[model samples]
Target: MMKIIYTLFSCLIFTSCFNIERNCNDYKTGTFQFNYMEDGVEKTGKFVRTEAYSIDYFEGKIDSSSVRWINDCEFILTNLHPKSNQEKRSIHMKIISTSKNSYTFEYKYAVKEGNRPDRVVKGIAKKIE
Candidate 1:
């Protein structure tokens, strides 16, 4: 029993020390492709991001958003020209993990409204340029 407990503790310590790679700065300003499912259809969107702004091209329309970085791994994005009430809300985004050419991120509305619960969506983006 003592040996088993020691082995389990050692495993936990080793796993805790492992960290995911996050070279966020390298992804701060780039063109990237994100694939998602919408209405049961797989869709791809491309976006160009700078330090302060981002332009997204999706479904034959271009939308722009202003970006404010809270840190190297997190930021908030506000739509520049929102056509609906929901679009006017700011989105909070965080990079959960990263790789050589892609990063996994989660985003949600920054502010809760009405009785709707906050919803977080996670996706992976691949750098294209």
Candidate 2:
């Protein structure tokens, strides 16, 4: 019995399967910041969640287009208008684990292929007044 239960638990964790009510209430609704490592360099940014579904980002002499939430933890960023064939890409962020004031998140864009196709973004955000 113990062996069977352990095997099932291992399978679930390794499969990246999440089934929890991490609703909008659990996510912070205010300004936050994160440092991203891109191209072997680090970039810092300040992000704001105006409401449950709206966002704006700025930091380190850089500001980005508005972002909006699609679901509880998922968000879409439109950096550019509908120019040519691309209409801007979407970024999906999910809370993999959390404490009271912080959460571990993973981010990825919907794409076909590349090295590290699934890039995990570990961010720690704090709520502000």
Candidate 3:
């Protein structure tokens, strides 16, 4: 029992000391690239984000969204010209971890739906410029 307790305590202490690096400020205003799957096909998209807005280019279409910062590591993105009701919803984005020129983020709809749990998606974006 003592040996097991010591092992568990050591693991808890080691994990508490490990911290993920988040340099979200470095990615606030830059061009970034990411990949996503749609209809079982993989596609790549590029976006340019400023402090107040973000413009995305996918395929030949362009979409714009407003950026409302919640903090240095989190923000809300609302479509500027939503074409449908689903598109009108705002997405909450949180930067989970970051490297020198890239970041891993999780995002989901800001508003919850009736009787349904929120679906969060994680992705990585690499800064291009």
Candidate 4:
């Protein structure tokens, strides 16, 4: 029993020491491609981001957003021209992890609406240029 406990403790210690690499600065301003599901279809979208702005091309529509960096790994994105009530809400995004040419992110509404629960979505984006 003591040997088993020691082995389990050693495993836990090693696992807890593992960390995900994140180099957010490399992705701060670049062109990126993301693949996601929309209406039962998998689609790819591209976006170009500068320090303070981002332009997204999706579904043949070009939309722009203003970006405010909260930190090196997080930012708030507000649509420049919202067409609907849902679009008016700003999104808060954080870089969860990153690899050599890609990063994983999680995003959700920046401001909660009434009693509605906030929904967070995660995706991976690859830097294209």
> Each prediction's Cα lDDT score?
0.95, 0.60, 0.97, 0.97
Tens digit per residue, CA lDDT, model 2, 14-114: 77765543544566466665677778988766666654343445444443445566666666655534443443655666666655655567776655344
Tens-digit lDDT track for model 4 on 1-129? Answer: 999999999999999888788899999999999999989999999999999999999999999999999999999999999999999999999999999999999999999998989899999999999
| lDDT tens digits, residue span 51-129, model 1 | 9999999999999999999999999999999999879999999999899999999999988887989899999999999
Q: For all candidates, what are the clash counts?
A: 0, 0, 0, 0
Local distance difference test, candidate 3? 0.97
Q: Rank the candidates by lDDT, best first.
A: 4, 3, 1, 2
| Residue pairs with clashing backbones, model 1 | none
TM-scores vs. true structure, each candidate: 0.88, 0.55, 0.90, 0.89
- Candidate 4 vs. true structure, TM-score: 0.89
State the displacement of the C-alpha of residue 65, model 1, in Å, after optimal TM-score superposition: 0.3
Model 2's C-alpha root-mean-square deviation from the true structure amounts to: 5.5
TM-score of 1: 0.88
Top of the candidates by lDDT? 4
Model 2 lDDT, full chain set: 0.60
| Residue-level lDDT tens digits of model 3 in 1-129 | 999999999999999889888889998899999999999999999999999999999999999999999999999999999999999999999999999889999999999989899999999999999
Give the Cα error of residue 57 in candidate 4, in Å: 0.2
